[model samples]
Target: MTLPSALLLAAVVATLWIAARSWTLPAFPGRTDFVLMQLSAAWWSTAVAIESIVPDPADKLLWAEMAWLGIVCTPSLWAFFLWSYTRGELPERWRLALVTIGLATWAVALTNDAHHLFYTAVRPVNAEPGAALVYSHGLLFYVVTIYIYAFMVMSIVVTASGIHRATPAYRTHYLGFLVVMAVPWAANAGYVFGNLTLFDLDPTAFSFLMMDGIFYWLITRRRLFDLLPVARDALLDAVPDPVLVLDGDGTVVEANPAAQALAGDHAAIGRRLADLPGLSALSTMVAAKPATVSGPLTLDCGGSPRCFEVTWVPLTAGGGGREVGCLLMLRDVTHRHRAEMRLEDTVRRLDLARLEAEERLVAEQEAKRALNGFLSMAAHEFKTPLAIIDGAAQLLLMDAEVKAPGMLPRLEKIRRAVRRQINILETCLADDRLSDPAFALRRDRLELPVLLRAAASAQGDAAPGRRIELELDGCPARMTGDGPMLELCVHNLLNNALKYSPAGTPVRLHAWSERGPDGQSHLAQSHLALSVADQGIGIPDSERERVFDRFFRASNTGTAAGSGVGLNMVRRIAALHGGTVTVDSRLGGGSVFTLRIPLCEEAPCEDRMAGMPAD
Candidate 1:
């Protein structure tokens, strides 16, 4: 055998060896392109071998083999180039179509030769010195040759363009494949142009064999066979749970069949880990440690809930090199986790029930103690008012100055003080009754502006000299609630505003009707937002949230007497009416307390307002 033939035989043998060996190795990068290129090169070598052996100048078998070889190798070469160019992103349909077309062409060519329609005869002869070979040319033979060259050129151009568009990581391998493909392509062009003949030197076939050798070297250097075998086995294997491995850069370097199955058939490999759903926490866990760690993870896999116990271990290169990637092993633990959670929930409920029983017992005892303390405080509060009444009455009876200039005013002050004290006691008793748990709202439709006016009038009567202004804008809207309870809430808010604000500051009470989002007619029915703004020393920022708690008061508002239950009562009443009370206040800058209530349901009006109540 000559040097070229010897090289061809070696290349063919190596191609078969790698194809067989690739089934066993762990799948790694660049393996599929390597395998496909090997097969194409092997077929090309078989054609070259046949051409060298056949002595006939116009041998039909020799021409048929060349045409069949071109048909088989052309698509395979294109596919390999595509895989190299795209880094394996070429769609499966494109590859299948190419292969199908090549095989159909081969079948037609083979049938034509068998029927003697394309080539008629064969003859053997010595052609030239040291170039003992056969050659053939016919109408169909030259036509197929032209088609093959044209197709190869087109495939190469497309492959080259795809290669240029590839990412930087795969560009080197694509460029190398391009050069290898270019050599055979250029050699064939030279032969066609008569610059070189098959008898003189088959440099194209020799160069092709060299390209195949270079491909083998590159493949073995990167252990590309490893990737092919892993991919094949993963497709064949059946594992229970999703499993994947990630490189140090957090790209999914490998995934098993089960992993792909769980990930919804999406391509898992060569994609960044962060791009995958429900994998962010796993990535974070692995990155934080960069060492072996195992824990439970809850994930929404698509729309279905899944739980996993994932173990992550760092992967190291050979010779004790630093860590390069992580090997993730996932085991489905959804059933186990749910079982454990159910048992824990059962125990927690039992504990909570027992704690609640204890709390109820303690609450009853505290209520009894509170009642006793309240009675003592009530007696003291009543004694002062009773003493003032007794003193005023005795003065009126004994003094002839009862009709003096300021005598009547002093007596009225005494009476007002007694009335205020009585009102406080009555309010406290009502509040206690409302807290009895059996209390529920006796809801009814009532005009909101009328309620506001009544509340403002009562506050003005209580604080005789304080100016309480009412700004009733638009028609009076109505709301559904216990009229007495709502009145109490409005009364308390206005009272607190007047008590806290400086005397002579205009206490503005406003009422209005407005629309809401729900398009229903809230006729005379709207958010009766009664805002009692005070130009008083407002509640401080730190104490704003606590102001609604019973008995809570701002320490900075010195000597300002209050029971501190007014705002708390307002909140409870708002909650009862399915509404809420909010305070916008600044220390030393006054406050606006808004009571938002849904309009009463049955109030008559000419036009119905359209909107939902503001909360």
Candidate 2:
């Protein structure tokens, strides 16, 4: 045997050895093993066919047998790889089909030797000095080449599609295998097509050898076959709760299939822990300390509310050194936590109920004491006024001089004082009348600015020494409401302003139509605003909020003689008219009290018929 024959025999032996190993290799030996085997077989067959066509008759039958074996094995190996990868299932029908195809191809090649169809003849050539070679081709030879090329393309497509369908975990393994498979297939096609001409340098055999190394490395290093058990164990372990391994920065470094099942079907790896519900707070807690906390947590998995007892512990080495990350174990504690919270709430409510009962008892006792004191004070006030009226009437009746003009004036003064005292008593007794449901409003229309002017006039007349001013900026339009009540609101505001302000300072009653942001004029048709401002000792900031409360008195008013009910009454009347009264005041800078009212159009006719004074 020549050197070529020896090399061919060695290549064929290597191909068979690698093929047998691939059947049970631990990891994907990649396409390199199959591709190398195919190339070796093809090389042997083509060499034998060429050698058979030569004039040399020695070993012609052996070369023909070798060529036939190569032809049969190449497609058989290619078909096995294609079937295993693409379909992911190996059925008896597919195996039988592959066997039948291989036998048919081998039989056709054998028949070509007798009938000169597959390969017509072989011609020996000495193109290069001291080199012997033969070239052979036939009709069936070209047809087989076409079939092989078509099958190679189909294999590439199927393998690539299968790789694409694989999970991300297995993608790298499959892709590496694809590269190993593709290289030799491409080299074989190049060789068959005469595109490659490297003497004694068989790319097919080299590719297979490279693929064998790849498969060995994959099996030893990647441990692809071990993944199934690991994945199964991970799923079984994660079935109880959401199990996750987080990096220091709060990213999900690893998660099992169960974690995915609980959280979401989306890829969780490398996603920021903060992005997941309930997990973000865990990150914060871990940063602070290793402790357990139970709370209500929401998860995006299904927007389900879960209660979790989150346990955080630092991962430590044998020497008590801190590891790079910490383990977070979450246990569903919703029912338990909720029950505890409900118990706490029940205790708090019971305590509050007990305290409220105590407060009510104390308040009842206080009310009794305050009623006793109020009655005594009321009796003393009533007795003094009654005694003065009695004494004045007795003096008038006892002396004829009491009937004189000076005596009558003193008598009138006594009468006025008694009336004032009676009014105070009436106000106190009728306080509950304000809350009466049947306290109907006597509505009417009156010019607001004119009424304001009249109230200012009356205030000035009552205190002639004080100067008052009226700054009526808008139309003196009529508004509907109870004229007397509206006038009383104006009067009380003016009185409070005068009583608090210094003498000789201007007391201004201002009315205006203002446009608001809603593009509606406040006093255009339905609403009116009137302001009574005083240049007096303004209310203190602390007391401003309570100024409208009944019996609320400011400390700095310096014993100004007036009931604190004026502003309260003003607020009540404004509210009755579907309006509100607000105060804008600063201490020592005087106060601006604004009354907003819903206008009544029919107030003028009613006021005129009732002989009521109009503004």
Candidate 3:
């Protein structure tokens, strides 16, 4: 039996168990990459374990190549994990460069047939079971080994460098990390240079089991910095934004340099909130204890006054979760405030009320036109990148069919993603434009039956294969709304149902008038309800609330082309009518979008806009 192979498998299992436990930790400080490291090591161990006992030379060679995927990444991931753990961040460029070199190294190892730069030769026959694959290391293999050790040494040096400045609690954690990150590489180096082997197998993979054990102890017993506060020097102090924390009694327990400078009290700690005259307006909100943003609190900083908006939230602790303190973040809004003041002064200097009103109206109209044009132009600009990607994919498609057949479907997926983006671009822009106040609602009396029937018929015509059933017999004949906007809403809703649901499915369009709760129209304002129900892929329960939010698509709507803004546009239109829109949906069962609008009741007036003077 291959005892080394069994131990290697045990290493794989133990590492994966730790990886599972690590998932519950917070995201940053290399927590994500830490789990990735474990998973990568687990696979490497599994491959090496299998390679030890496999009888066929071809099979052994395949597993050896597979192991290189994890091997090439050993140093880079270690360096990144240590840096992120100690410093809380690694620059994106460094991460990209490391990953690129690692993957390129793996690729060279993978296709060693063409160049043989990674391994000069590989075979199964020169050794017994439970032994390393028979292979002659090439120049590139040693080069990559040096590359790995470079990162190993660099990580140890960088982590230890910060030890003096780190708090006493974190300095020990730093030392522990340097040990945990370097052990496997140390074993790998020993195996290559000093012939350290377990039952004729490389000891590198087996060392991970010991590394995982130490990593677990560091996290649970020694209190690794994953859950600790931001590193005082790199983050809390270096940030330009002012931050302050107070105890329950309003004593300033902590204040960053920016916060102290903003308050003009270098020694703000231990001072009560009431004593800080700069925070008088903020002090009043403490009794209320609401987590909210308030006030442009003006601070007289040595004659140069600065205005700040306070965003505060209650910080609670202990068993009963009693309010322990509050954290305050101050954002300087002096420039915006000064701009407003300047605009007000300019307005006051203007001639007369009538001229001001005329000028304001003209300015608003011009701004609206310019804004709409800009949004459209910006949306189109996004297509330039997408088009470039699509063209590249198209060129690769012909090449991929011959050289890399497996990549054909991936290229097709990219093409599909590009086309979907194009389809949704206009709707996204249109929904974005809806937020402008200049896109005013012009409500007019509308015949409900005529309007709804026209919409359903048009949608049905466009998608000729499906049935759009209209239930409008009980609906009241008249309502008030923006005619074009209402038509747009109906079209959007209908389009979503048809697009998401399977072809030839019947989509029910129901509209009816609801009498007052007392069964008298005069007692309360009468209302009308309209619904579109489709038996298509329904919205997931978690996402139902956000389905009408701009650019939110249901997770289940896969590969069905859709502009996520359709429902959001419907909601905006509904709001303009002084009504509400909501969805009732279930996964695989379909969705019902209900839009309820208040019906006009006073004297059943016709289109009032016809006789009313324009603003």
Best by lDDT: 3
Question: lDDT (CA) for every model shown?
Answer: 0.65, 0.61, 0.74
Per-residue error for 252 in candidate 2, Å, reads 11
CA RMSD of all predictions = 16.4, 16.5, 36.9
In angstroms, give how far residue 513 of model 3 lies from its true place.
80
lDDT of model 2 at position 61 = 35
Global fold similarity of model 3 (TM-score): 0.40
Tell me the lDDT of candidate 3.
Answer: 0.74
lDDT of 1: 0.65
lDDT for each residue of candidate 3 in 120-183, tens digit (9 for 90 to 100): 8765535655335657889998988888788778877877876765644456766787777677
Error of 2 at 613 (Å): 83
Q: Work out how many backbone clashes candidate 1 has.
A: 15
lDDT of 2 by residue, 200-309 (tens): 33344444445545644554354333222112232435368666666556666555565656566467656777676535655666666643433555444466666676
Which residue segments of model 2 deviate by more than 4 Å? Answer: 1-65, 127-132, 166-170, 195-221, 228-615
Question: TM-score, each model?
Answer: 0.40, 0.36, 0.40
Q: Candidate 3, clashing residue pairs?
A: none
Candidate 1: worst-modelled 10 consecutive residues by lDDT: 606-615
Candidates 1 and 2, the one with greater TM-score: 1
lDDT of 1 at 288: 71
